[model samples]
Structure formats: structure tokens, C-alpha cells
Target: MAQTHTVTIPHFVTEASVELTHLTAAYAMYGTPHIQPDGRSNILLVEHALTGDHQVDQWWGPEIVGPEGVFRTDQYCVLSINTLGGCMGTTGPGSIAPDGQAYGSRFPALTIRDLVHFEAAVLDELGIREVAAVIGGSMGGAKALEWTLLYPQRVRAALVLAVSARASAWQIGIQKAQMTAITRDPHYLNGDYYHTEHTPQQGLAAARKIAHLTYRGELEMDERFGTDAQTGENPLGPTLADSGRFAVESYLDHQASKLVERFDAGSYMILTEALNRHDIGRGRGGLNKALASSTVPTFICGVDTDILYPYHQQEHLARNLGNLIGMAKITSPCGHDAFLTETRQLVQIMHRFITRIST
Candidate 1:
């Protein structure tokens, strides 16, 4: 059985009231904190990607968070937070407002900095003034980058894998299209139709389908699905839906429906816009200044086959940051999703990186 702990921290987000609202953060402590009785806790904050929850062990396997895993709870206190704009047990746009209504379209626009600020509040509530390390992947990586900028002294080290310092213009363009697909649906009702009779299923599914293609690489799609038909129905059939179905289409449909069941459309829109507006250098300075500002030791990882966040982006992080301790390049055929699929390699990288910072 996994030991669980929940704590409520003060959170006054841009979307809500000015008064400090209670926020919930769930965590599982693995090992004891490496500190004196009165000293600061040796915490390792693990940030999750989009659609990911604090159930990192469930998604990746027990070895990644167990007594022997890189995060060995028996040796270190590990904390993973569900981000501010996420749906997984955390306070998000899908949550009920103080007036018992869902924030829905009324949820404020959240930046990556907003997420970092809330996370810092979590630490404050936990009596942790500083962390031994902060680690994340994908959008989680973006959060890690923001953390280094917002709380440089609080973090002694950073581990960012398979992600970019900022969302590219190309990435934002795709995100806009996804948002358009959802809003065009008559059921969306400008994001406040959650309690209504109809929900934006078609638009949400279409957006997911579009996103599924980018999450994978062309080579992976070609090798796995190719141009083969899924339903085996003749193209000359009467109805278009039954006329022809490609294997890739079937795969995408499965992925789309899965997200529709687990994720809220309103939360998706809010998070998507946040991602589109993501630029770590927005008010701070350019990438160089942002990286230079962080004094924490850094570990960067890149996936060779990733198309969404290419390997060069990792190189850019390592080059711009002055205190880079190591760079791990994962060679996988799984593309951008390799960080999830290639668990062993990720564990090894994390183990080495964490060990270096602990001592």
C-alpha cells in the first residue's frame, strides 16, 4: 500500500478571489528527509505533464517511485503536485467556484509562472524553505524552467527532460486550431455549458485527434499503422463512416475518446491557452538572460526521435545555463512520448542526477 498525505496551502489565483483560498496538494513520502530535526527538508518536487496526475507511480510503474527507484521514498521525501490548471484532483477550471459554480470560462488565464507561485505556496505550507531538486518532463519541463526563474534560491538543482524552454510559434499555432475546434461546437457555450444538457464532445474529440498526431513521430506512425485499413470495410460502401477507416484513424479515435472521459473541456481550453502564451522570457528577458539568472545546478535530457520538442532544444538549455551538470540524450523509436515509454533509461538518468545533488 502507498502512504498518502494531503495538505492545503494558501492560493490566491488570477481567476479567483483576492483572499487566500485553500489549495490541496497530494504527496507520498518515500524516505526520510535528509536534514537535522530543525533543518529544512530535503525535498524533490516532481512536476507532471499535461493530463498527468500525482499518480506517477501508477502511470510509470512502482520501480520509478519505490524504495529502490530513483526517487526512493525510503531515502528522500518526494512530492508531486497536480498543477493549477490541471484536472487531476487539483484546483482547476473544472472545479466549483466559491459560489458553487464551475469557473469554466471565467477561470483566469494561468501562466507557467502562476503554477510556480502556487507550488511555492505548497512548500511554504509544508515547512520546506528549499528543495534538493525539482524534476519534470514535457509541460512539466516548462514548469521546472519557470521554477528555476521564480525561485532560484529555493531550488538547488533542476532536471528537465524532453521539453522546451518556451512554446514555439508552431506549437502555439497548432494549439489555436485545437481551441477553435472545441469552441466551434454549439455545445461549448463559451466554456460555461458544463451543467447544460449538451457537452462539447465532438469538438473535444477532434482536438484530441489532432493532438495525438503531434504526440507521435512520422516514423512511428508509419511503422505501427501504415496505410492499412482498420475496419476492413470496402471504400465503395454506402456510408462514409463505414466506407473506410485507416489504422491511424482508429488509433487516434481511441486516444481521443480516452481523454474526453478523463479531462474536462473547460480545463483543456484554459490550459491550452496558457501553453500558447508560454514564453519564459516574456517579461524576464530573452532565453539567455533567463537561463543565466538561475543559479541551480541543472540536468537536461533530450529524446532523439522527438518531433514536438526536438533534441536541439535540450542542447539550447544546456548551452544557455551555466551550471549544467549532465545531459542525457534518450535514443528511442517512440518519439516525444519516449519519456513515458522508456522508463528504465529515465530512471537511470534520474538516479544519477539525484545522487549527485544529494551529496
Candidate 2:
């Protein structure tokens, strides 16, 4: 298990200058810290996706970061910080407010840049002035990209997978629908449902179902379930209430329920809102100009079947970034979630990228 640590920032001002007092950052580190001759730790920062926490090994584990993993603990110091507005041990809607209640509905808005700023502060507290590499996928990828731009001198390299420089209209539209589902739930209680007996579990489940569809490939979905009905349920029953469900519906339901049991609905809303606002070029001029200005070594990867963030986004980044080695296409049937599902392929790509930079 990774050891958890917290750093208290007396005053954390957001990019918009929103004052956030008494901010706390929760993070975990793997492997022993190895200080380089240049006074910086030989560290590799791993940013997690939407529902991920500092527990990188739990989801990524031996497949990505253990002794047998691509980023072996024995080789380099590995660390992961729970992003700002995260539910798991990080400051978010579930965290306590100055008024002695959960922030809940009152939690301030956040952006991808704000998350990178928070991570920078955490790194400062740990005396980590620079990192060997920064890596992430999806929402995590947005942060990794931001880090390369925000602190170019501090980051030696960055690996971003399954994300874009900015969230597209299609992405925002889907997120808006998910947000609407959460707010429309009767139990949402205007986002201040912490003290209530019921949370917006049903609403969150609906949102997850919608997201799950986008996370998976259409061909894979059809191959797995096709037109088959769930064994115990009948789709064409006499009564509508007694109608059976399709195999696909059952799979989505399981995914939804699993999230509801482990995640906070309010945090989900905040993070999704943050994701919708992800724009690496914001306030830094235009996308091409912004990427072209950065000299940090960057490795871009995209899922060939990803519908949410298509491979073209990575292609664009590779074309523009001043210090890029081109984009690596991860071929998998898992769609947008291929970064997490296709571990072996991801490892190979990352290994090659790291080797090229090191040599």
C-alpha cells in the first residue's frame, strides 16, 4: 500500500484569483526517493483519471508501476497526487468548509490549470524541484499537458494519452447531459445532500451509464452482448414492468452501481465540470502557438478506437509541440479506455519513449 501524506497550504488562490483558504493536498509515493546530483529527486509523476486516487497500484498495479511494470518502483521514485476537487482524500465538495460543513454545493469551480497548480504546490512542499517524466491519460492527460506548459523547466518529459488540448463541443454536450441527470434527481437537493438520507445515486448511475457507452468501442460492445437478452430478464414480456433487460444494459448497470458505492455525487459534478473546462491553450494565446512555445519533451498517445478523444487530437499535438517525438497509436478494441485496459501495449510505447529520451 502507498503511504498517504497531506500538505496544508495556508492560502491557495486559483487561476481566477478565487481565494481558497486552508487547502489540503493528499498524495502518495511509491519507491524510495533518490536525489539526483542536480538536487532534484529522480521522480516520475503519475496523474490519475476521473475516478482515480493516489492509489496508483490499485488500478495500475504490477501491470504499470510495480517490479514487473513499466515504471518499476525500484528504478525511479514514483508519486501520484489526488487532483484538486477529488473525493478521495483530497480537497473537494466532500471536504469540510470553514462553516464546519462539507463544501458540497458551495465548492468553488475549478479548471485543469488549477489542478496542475495544486500539484506544483505539493511538489514544492516535498522538495521535488523537477521530475524526470510526467504521465497520465484522459483527464490525467490534460493535467500532464498543462504541467509541461506551466513548468517547462521542471518537467523533463510528458506522456499524454487519450486526451486533447481542449474539450470539444461534443465532449461538453455529453458532460452537460450527465450534469443535468444529476441535478434533475429529486434527491440531489441542490447539491447540498450531505446530511440527507438519500444521495443522487440513481442520477449518478444514469450519468455513469451514459459515460460507459462513450468509454467503450461500439464494435466491442456489439461483439460482447449483441442482441442477446440477459438470462434472467425478458425484454419482450407481457408487462412493461416485468420486461427483461439486454446483456448490455445489465453490464452498464453493474458499472453504474460500482461507481455509486465508491464515489461522491457532488465530487463527480465538480470534476466533470472541471473536465469540460480543460483548455491547455487558454490565456496562453492559441493552441498552435501555445504548444509550439513549449520545449519540454512530450510523448503523445491516443487510442485508435477512442470516440471521446479521437486519435486526431494526438496527431495535432505531435504536429505542433516544439519538442515532440510524434504520436503513438494504441490499437485496442476498448476504445477511450484503452489506456487503462491495454496495459501491455501502453507499457511498450512508454518504455520506448523513455528509452529514447534517456539515451
lDDT of 1 by residue, 253-276 (tens): 899999999988877887778777
* Candidate 2: worst-modelled 10 consecutive residues by lDDT: 33-42
The list of candidate 2 runs beyond 4 A from truth reads none
Q: Stretches of candidate 1 above 4 Å error? A: 1-5, 15-22, 26-28, 31-38, 235-242
In order, the Cα lDDT scores of the candidates are: 0.80, 0.88
Best by lDDT: 2
As a whole number from 0 to 100, the lDDT of residue 256 in candidate 2 is: 98
User: How do the residues 1-359 of candidate 2 rate in per-residue lDDT, one tens digit apiece?
Assistant: 78889888677777777787788888888887787879666688999999888888888768688766778788877899998898888889888988899887888888999899899988888888899889999999999999999999889889999999899999999998999999999999889998889999999999999998989999889999998998888888898897989899999999999999999889889889889999878888889999999899899999999999999998988899989965799998889999888888988998987786676
- Candidate 2 lDDT for residue 10: 71
